[model samples]
Target: MRTASWGRQAGGYAAVVTVAETAGLTWEKDDRPLRGVPGAVRRDHGDLVKELRDLVKRVGVQLGTLTRALEGGFTVDTVHPYGWWRAELAGHPLARAVVRRLIWEIEVTPGQWRPVLPEAEHLPDAPDDALVRLWHPIRSDPGTVRAWRDLLTERRIQQAFREIYLLTPAEEDTRVHSNRFGHLVHHRRMFALFRARGWASGLLGPWDGSDEDEAVRTLAAGAWQVRFFHARADWAGDHELATTGQVRFARRLEGTWREVPLAEVPPLVFSEAMRDVDLFVGVTSIAADPDWTDRGPERAYWELAGFAELTESAEARREALQRILPRLEIANRCSLDGRFVVVRGDLATYKIHIGSADILMEPDNAYLCIVPSRRKSDGQVFLPFEDDRLSLILSKAFLLASDTKITDESILTRIKRGA
Candidate 1:
């Protein structure tokens, strides 16, 4: 074997050489420090050992704290270990490497750090089961998976409601209004069933008749008057049609009906009754809309009916509503009291009476209106309009107050302040 020398002169001058060459070894920049290495290598090795030991201890303590915090349930973010706890762990190199082994995505801000949870499209084979099963491939914690499933369900419900609302006819007198005939006929009958179930009687009002025709007769029996009109062109003797005719309201007063100018009828009655009519119109509109092939409203109706059938008593329904209401963005401004969700509005608050597939609103003693519009994002039956305007503004207000994105920032700030 050829011996390696520390000093080897290629020319006449003295050669300077490294210690590794003298030892018959070649050093590489990427080489790991070995035990018994002397001088600078020894110091580097010692320092590395101490640093690793310290890092291991720190990680152990942090993991223990995390385990304890998650003993109850896994949360996306924990308040106990300080806010941005995940961020803190990622700040250290070794600790970050350790944390990468755990499945977590840090949420930094809007448009940043949002974890892309598995979507329904991710698993082709899974149907309704996809929400819970898709995360298994990633080995997500059970609690996290459960939370994600709930979120998926919530989003689906919201989408269903949005579809229902969007497909509904916004203006009156369209051909679609004809579809409301059946719903209007069945309205009183449904109200009676709602009352029998111990729903808010005040909101539902009183049903004085047994059938649809009887109910209409009873409704028209009071000072309340209703009218219908037909516009027909006069036929000339020779076959030409006359063009001039005026629209009028036929009002029944003191058992005698008379045709009067449209202005004779109170404009308020027409406006209010139109809104009331729209409720039934909206329900019928859902099925008639071409986009409702998914049976969103029908499914929502069945689900509400099922919940009512399963729940035996008023108290049970109240309890169920309490659990379900918090998940709804619209319920934020509404306080639950027994069977009622008291919705607070700027001018006046209304009591939302929850029944099987129906939601009635008592804006005041004079009005006990059924909310005709199903929530377009979720299938929760909701009032479509309030005081002539769409009820969406109220829903938006509730959403603004309960927004999770906004709450996250507030929580992060509080955590940083150690509050």
Candidate 2:
């Protein structure tokens, strides 16, 4: 029933078909932009229709024109829902391209099976099986589930309770702003990761060289450097952690590295700490007293669970790192400062901050936060952070796209956005 064009051609499709799928009813919010959220679950069509109407009014444009604008240039906010949305601005080719990719993501794949609820009166107070089903499709893919892990590094630094990234945009700022307290406090987690390794055996006990083993060794031996930043401005005071900063380090101490206290470790040692690793798991705790508690041993022992070495010789970890890096790439538009990174493949297209964050473990799970330079649509204008909007937008966008259309637009939009 649909006519195909060059833009709509199936050959343009590229996103990997996920091996796993989620179950449940998917739904669209009855709001514009926000309504764009999608997932593998069933949702109400009326909600999407209401969303389309609201979006038309919000942007002061006709529905078709708005759709065209989005078709031309928009970003995918949801995947499973396959709902397409855009700001509805006139002929902006760049924006149009984004829309096309969004559209592509929606099309060229299996569509959701569940229908939307007709009214709020019928809505259940608790999240229902439909909601759970919606999450299942997303949950099925191990890679997709683990994609957000990189965000934890940022949280580790922000745990210090300061908007550190806003204070220093460049590494050079460290010297000018150097109050011994600010420097130490801002980088408390990095110091912890460096210090923790010396106590690795004591806390973790013996380098068995498991995955976590190599990870600990790489840090303890100073073979890796922590890079990334945590922007404090993005903190709403609601989230304890925010943003990740990364720096790669050169390896020197291969055989044995010793632990040193905060007082014993010199300031410039951070530069030396920069070595082989792609990311620095920012440290949250500092060895102010050089004392470890029963809790410390348990925490340290658990932290080493994902341990793995960083030698360039093995291809398996390299493959894992390859997978890990793409996920890390998600921070493209997200910021601890509430600035969004324009998600694009060309690293050169982005003006990024070279920094790192430490990873922290909660009783149940671990998380990260990072601080990086804000990328504008053009890499010139700096946008302020909007945590709620950004996170929800990306989450929805991921859910809307089928693996086949995650990167293509026209095809995705044609199927998702309708007459």
Candidate 3:
């Protein structure tokens, strides 16, 4: 009396369906003359019923194997067997139909494992609301979700690249290749560069021939690339001067430099060259904002003050500060020197002499400091405020402070009362 919903096969295509139990088994085919005849009454019904029972048994075994695979911990290697089984099952009309009716979802965890139920909602550390909203549809039709997950994975990889390296809108648009192998190669190179820079967390690759679905699942589970890009003058020594003599092009891989034909370079290699060129230009340029160079020390000092102001009690503020201060870059760490704050940079340790209207630096005794500019131009003007490294440190400190405690207005109550 147990009913199992199986997929409906019409014109060789299996469509999803629901099932209900009945006292007698009946076989109904759209093209066949037989219509809902009870198995007990018809002689041919015996063979039909036996065939259906066998089909159901086979499907049940496949489903069980898939479930156990998920439970034991699914990985790229582990899923291969399941994937093969799924393919075999899908090739059989009855098995394919049965699988279409099965429900599966990814259990959101530090490990991306498939589960029989939507268990992400029950996990305390999981983003249940967001996962439910985004992953519900994917779970409903697990058999076909690989393509969707692959797209998601590709987007995440591209985002990781963008976070560390600046890309033009046009360059970003052009990065995706129609060729899957070419695209994979591009991601492989990107991951290698990311790892080399010490920006990778967790296992980044076996990218040369990895299954796309496994790659997607792995990235979704907290693996990340670093958020900074570098192009060294020494790294540029590999390329020949351009015919125009206006630019240089090179390729540096595994600490070895080589000249590559610019015109014949692969799309992936060309994209990498673009990143190096952009970084080189960005670092060597100056800024249009005359005041941009002198703004770093002021901004860094204010960021510290704003971070400290989040907690009301002096002791609480000190506790919150302990959590925030370590996020600062070693070079940008400021020390109170009587009335001034000292910031050590690569070239010099700047003693920032603060004033009501203008700030100044000593050793160089310069009114302004040179920093990198964010301006998009063939040529750049460097200024102190434009150095993304300093900005990132300050931003991290602010975020740490904001996340540590609630910023109550009670901290300013005493000052208002005095006024």
Candidate 4:
């Protein structure tokens, strides 16, 4: 099975919140910081592709600058923030191309579809379309994509194009809500992946709304859909924002910004429950639960409830801190245990080893990983834990013996070598 990841949720949230907060701060200083940037870019498939093209071009400009730096051996390392050049280049043009090619293989290519057989070993040779999709981005050029234009349907074309567009920001398998057309329309956010054409691949969100429910009905049938949290019955508004990750909201109070913990939010405001769950579950619960819109004093009541959840005040906050301590401690690390690899990037990383499974025709499909993270900590690197690792699942990592240059193999090798 393809991997699922949530690493982008929190980082995306942080980016937005930081922008909001920074905008607010600049407003206080009488200077506009986000004036030129769109409030937040959102789009459907077509518009998303356009936005992606624009983003890629911009990124290309940056990559050009980094290309200059690399010639001088300016490797991006944790010890030096200056090496952001590499990080900036991580999920760029080439990466985006890989994503699109994979999506075409998983979603559009015909006859290449392989069931998630319980005991199949190694994947069959993908259809010609799948291979073309894989190489398209790497070899993308007017002539290259044009010669194969007839090979992809308009939808697949757009999808693959968007996949390439998405690659730049999809480091560690953190796909974005904006990248997926209708994701933010349903849950606050979501991530998706696909491997072929004429096949179905995408993720389900945590919320259930009319529009989202409708899309899911259309997409879920005869395809793969994994709903992380069941939508609550009462939620009235789409809490797509909740899926952004370890979300915390703050409102200006008496000229000061106060952190509003999720748990402290009025339970009645949530159409569902939010206490005692992992990152995705708790946040998605709040977003899908339908108690936020009742007619009442929004601020006063919320503040009172927030204080109430703090009955033990400091102790309760401390416990809440303890609950998130592991996540916080390893927020940007990746770990490995036996056959599984768990990643904890800005989003979540959860992977399982299929080595023992009989679904592969070769050893290449032995491992399936979600989002992965690479961090330099005291000169030692970490992989996922055997169990007890809780993060969003993103990306799939397959192993190949040395000498393979396929994207998956290259990525794994780079990760291993870096670690």
Among all candidates shown, the one with the greatest TM-score: 1
Task: Residues 331-405, candidate 4: write the lDDT tens digits.
Answer: 334344333333332212333321211111122332222233422333121222111122222112222211133
Q: How does each model score on lDDT? A: 0.32, 0.26, 0.30, 0.26
lDDT of 2 by residue, 297-386 (tens): 333532332122221212222222233223433544333211112222221112111111122222222222222123332422211222
Writing each residue's lDDT as its tens digit, candidate 3 over 162-228 gives 1112233543444431111111012333334434422332322334422221111111112211122
| TM-score for candidate 2 | 0.17
Query: What TM-score, to 2 decimals, does candidate 1 have?
Result: 0.20
TM-scores of the candidates in the order shown:
0.20, 0.17, 0.18, 0.19
Q: Whole-model lDDT, candidate 3?
A: 0.30
Task: Estimate candidate 4's RMSD in Å.
Answer: 24.7
- Give the candidate order by descending TM-score: 1, 4, 3, 2
Query: Which structure is stronger by TM-score: 1 or 3?
Result: 1
Give the CA lDDT, 0 to 100, for residue 346 in model 4: 23
What's the ranking of the predictions by lDDT, best on top?
1, 3, 4, 2
Which portions of model 3 show Cα errors greater than 4 Å? 1-159, 163-261, 288-419
* Model 1 spans with C-alpha error above 4 angstroms: 1-118, 124-149, 153-332, 346-348, 355-419
Judge candidate 1 at residue 145 and give its lDDT. Answer: 44
lDDT for model 4 comes to 0.26
